[model samples]
Target chain A: MLAEMIKFEISRLLKRRTLLFWGIVLLIALFTGIIEYLGMGTPKRTVFDAFSFSTSSIMPLLLAPMAGFFTGGALVEDSRSGLLSLIFSKGVSAFEYVTSKAVTSALSQMCFIGITLVVFFVALLPFFPMGSIYIGAQHYSEAFAYNEPVAYCFLIALLFITAAVAFNGIALLTSVWVKNTFVVMAAPTLLYMGLIYVMSMDATKVSLIDPYANLALIDVYIPVSILHMVCYWAVIALITHVLAIAAFSFKKDYM
Target chain B: MNEVLQVKSLTKRVKQKVILQDVNLSVSEGEILGLIGPNGAGKTTLLKIVSGVVRASSGSVWFDKSAGIGIVPEQAALLGDMDALQNLRMLSSIRGKIGTSEIKQTLKRVGLDPDNKKAVRNYSLGMKQRLMLAQAIMEHPKLLLLDEPTNALDPLGIIDLRMLLSELAQAGTGIIIASHLLNEIERMCDRVAIISGGKILRQVNLRSTEQTPIEVTVSTAYDWDILKRWAESVHVELQKLTPNKGLPRGILKTKMAVSQVISELQSAGIAIESISHVGPNLEAVFLEYAQLEGGVYR
Candidate 1:
């Protein structure tokens, strides 16, 4: 039963529509990066610069919330459709059901965003040749970016996917009571914008606890290690996932 | 009869109010148990508790999970996006026990075309009800829990449902049905439980050939004054059904056999224009139980 639940949930989260949605989002980000590069006064922008600029700005702004949108109201929708009761009636325990939802939501978003970032970087490499000398701001780890640009992009992709998983969990948590899909999608996005605002305020008074910067890995705040933010955002996702499971376990699904 | 389920000392309290109190009920193999009660009398709650959708505050419900359990809720518990085949296929994937042929057979049994590719959202209410029934009985469960199974079913669909349930019961499935259709309950159930105030007020065995409630409806142009007096003198329970003077005389229900009721009515000098046999009158019995819950007390 657990295996079947996992199969169906993964199927639910990994629809072709979700893939198309992420594709369109990456295309928009790529075009935006191209337009921004055209407006820049420099002609020596490398492939790494294009990738870094797109990942620096658009990933946290769009992909994380889009991840939330893809799977936010799944459980609540199931509750409203009477599928929850039907599934429970079949003897599938609560633990297995929640586990399947959490696992599939995180795993599907990881696959979507990870593939999008990799594709975006590859798509830009031919357009912008790698230069022997590179200069860019907001790279967070400039030494690592210039020396091992590919590794740097993968690390950023890893952090972005982690944040996307956390945002998805936040959406699922809101799904416990808020059945409206728009609110579920908008909640974590607003939080992301809010955290960025709080982090980008007057630098002297700015707090280092910005979740948005933690994932974006730009404008160093407390210089938290890359591994540390990965664990931190992963823990945030785990906490929300746990809360969603706990709340959903007690949610009365008469539908 | 083999006992398939036993719910002992079951009680459910939501907030401060008690929904179900000491609901001790059992369903035996091949037995159809009908639960009839007024709204808020805990009938649905009892079914939910037994179906494991709701937690009972106190008590234990014992049943063999290996034999399988089928359920039909009041509303359609189906995926609107999926076709009937897809919905059943997903369910079949859970246990991986049955194949497509069995699912198709179950769909056909419930009067639905298995090949129809239309999503359940496009299906009519009756079709949805049929699909719900199909999903429930796909595994040929030993125990079936149905709440308002006749909801949204057309007359033909209702007949098909009755026939299918009868077939399932004959094949040794213990069924518990909660419905407001007293006539259907009388015709389908071997036993009827009248519940009120979250308690089982009475359990009536309707299978007895001799003691089964037999309603004798007599159509007449005349009033029912004489029959009323005769009923009072003999201490037989008489109900003045259809008292609109423009209609029939009345329908008199009694525990007596058909011959006795007709002979007694004829001897009472009542002109019987037309008399028809009817099932036991549960309306008054249900009202009697409802009075206990402050439902019909005047």
Candidate 2:
């Protein structure tokens, strides 16, 4: 059932009309790498920096809210357009319906991340030789000896993924109550930004239970505390997602 | 016959307004039951409740001898971006009932080309409705519930649906259809329940062999006393009666000789402005009952 859901969802996302959104995102990532390469005259940036540049600055603005809006929109559209009814009519319960969506959206996000990893790595491989030349010419030979922050990069990558997965759950939750995609997307994004702003005001007491507030922890280097904080938020998101599915299945009516 | 669906005292409320109240009805195997009513009469709501898409505030719905219920909502609920075949696959795979071949057969019966790869959004409304119906029938539900199944169907499509439903019923499936088309209901239903103001105003059985045929009409400038006396002189059994303001309308029906009524009208000097022969059809019953319930029929 999960496989079938994934197949149909991927088919829907691959439709011609939706291709532009995907194209634009990929183009931005490629262009950002290309411009940075041309300006610096070399690819001295580490893999961590490349991934960080793509996910943090470019992807965050669109990908974060887009994933949320898309998930939420799909849910509401299924209900309002009567697609949900047709599924239920076939003997599939509400629990299966909501779960399949969450699963599918997470898988799609994972696919996107995988593609980004491939694209950035392949693009930067050719420029590494030139990067060595520029470093030698600048008399900064120690630049080649710089150790890759493999652990920190992996942690940040995990952090980014956790945030995306949590947003999918949040989008699924919004779908139960808000049929309009605009409202669903805006509400969570605004609340997340609001929480981020509030956290900036007072960093004394961090509530790791709130996933929205946890995005702030991703910016700095990965310490044991931040990893624990991310894990705490992940647990909270999982619990909220379970409760959301319960609310969707056990609720008396659509509001 | 095995009972397919049994709904008892089902009530639904929305924001303090009653949408359905004390509604009791059942559909048995090999039966086609029509749920007919005017707009806002809760016909769709009743169907939704049965389909499990909408929950009833206070009621119970039991389906067949089975533990599960299948539903086909009024809306064409296919994914807009997916083709008809894909939609069928999604629904069938989830249910774990029926196979690709079964879906193809059902779709073919409904004149939908399962091989066509056109997105559902590109399909015409009639085609979409047909696809939706195909999805429902493919489930092979013991109790088939539909809401305005022919809403967007063309003349031929409506005929095809009627024939398909009849065939399904003959195959031991119970079909409950909610529609405003009284003529179609008259031609199809084995039994019918007319609802109004969230209440089951009446239930009718079309297969009942015993019935009385009567022609009745109320016009202006007719005295109630004279009409009553004239009806009595003819010895007509008032099978069903209701006051239409001062012009009370009654089903002055009888199995007596037809000549008896003519002779009595002549003898009593009763002016017969107009009269219609009401048969065991839904139109007359719906209109009469709707008026009796003090509701307007649109």
Candidate 3:
């Protein structure tokens, strides 16, 4: 039943035209990046430099809001459409319903990020030329000493996936309490942007707790940063998911 | 018959406002129980509690575990983006019984085109009602809960629904219907429960085939005094109808009294114009319970 519910949620999310719209937006951003890189007329660089520039500069801005938009209004939409009553009548437990929604939304965000990464790499393929590997400072050098540029790209994709999952979790939690679609989408994005602002003011200590800040570290020892980001965001996701389950379980009125 | 649903002392209070109070009711297999009430009488809340869509403040609802239940809410609780077939498939899948052919057949049974590809958003109100009915009956549930099921139905749709419900009841599906259509309730329900101020005022057994008092309407060219004297002699209650336009009407407790009045009128050289039995209808019974003063049925 859980698997079927997850499938249903994923199908519902996929049917939203906004998913395709966001995919197009991500492609356009990648296109703009390629055009700008071409205009730079700088010496050719390795694939890792292109991946770093695209992900660090563009991915967060696009993917975070996409994650929020996709997940934020899910519960609210169900309530407004009266589908919540129908679903609950089918004997679905609140825990099962919430977890299925959370997992499905997270996976959908990952898929969106995955598509963006593919678009980034594919768009950069023509621009990749024979040049020195653009490994960053000492930490990046140490991190990628034995790995290739593609490995760095994979690590960057993982970072974006973690950030997407975290943002989706926050959006899901907001949706649980907030009944409006606009508020559901805006609350998490606003919180994420605020955290980014706070981390910018004091990057040293705040970056440890900021998933987006860790996600923006494209030229650093990415494995460790990705690990930290995943752990921090995983905790946030777990907490929000648990709270959402409780709220949904204890709610007496679906209307 | 076996009990399919048992709701015990179900009370629902929302934000300190009492919605339903000590509402106890039950339905046996093959029984149709009509829940009739005025506006804001907690009928929908009770149905929701029984269907598990809303939790009661303090009470228990027990259903036969083996005989699953189906519900059709007041609103069209369906996915607007999906076509009818897709919506039915998704709902059936949740119950772990998904069959495409069965869904199509159900749609056909509900007077919907099985092949229509229009999303539910574009469906008319009547179509939506039919779809809701289709969803409820597709599972062949032992117990069905319907709230205002005939709200958007056309006359033809209503007749079809009435027949369908009657057929389902005969097949042993316990149904709890909450509707304001008193005539529909009178015709289809085996019993009617009148609710007022969040409480059940009375439960009337509509299935009783026992004879009730007959209302007689008589139009004559003779004086009204003649009919009054005849009614007094026959010891039957009689009331004069409006306009006194050559017609005197009265009510009699027995059909025999009606015949006696007609015989007396005939023998009195009165030109009889019309005679008819108005009713011992459910509407009268409903009005009696619905118009009680101060929430107390006198």
Worst 10 residues of 3 chain B by lDDT: B240-249
Best by TM-score: 1
Worst 10 residues of 1 chain A by lDDT: A207-216
Winner by DockQ between candidate 2 and candidate 1: 2
Please list the C-alpha lDDT of all candidates, in the order they appear. 0.76, 0.68, 0.76
Off by over 4 Å in 3: A36-43, A130-136, A139-148, A197-204, A213-224, B216-256, B260-280, B293-298
Report the lDDT tens digits of candidate 1 across residue range A1-255: 778889977655543355686677677876696778668776477887677666766675676568667767777677666677667767777777877888888887788888887788788878888852254444655555667767766677787888889888888888777877788778787777777688677664343444333233445445565556667888998899899888877765433
TM-score of 1: 0.89
lDDT minimum window of 10 residues, candidate 2 chain B: B64-73
Name the candidate that leads on DockQ.
Answer: 2
- Please identify model 2 stretches exceeding 4 Å from their true place: A1-20, A26-30, A33-48, A128-146, A203-233, B65-70, B216-252, B259-278
* Alpha-carbon RMSD, candidate 3: 4.5
Clashing pairs in 2: A89-B71
Candidate 3, residues B40-156, lDDT tens digits: the string is 999988987776667899989999744567788888888888899988987888777749999999999999998999999999999999999999889898999999999899999
Kindly report the TM-score of the first chain in candidate 2.
Answer: 0.73
Task: For residue A212, give model 3's deviation from the true position in Å.
Answer: 4.0
**Interface RMSD, model 2, angstroms:** 3.5
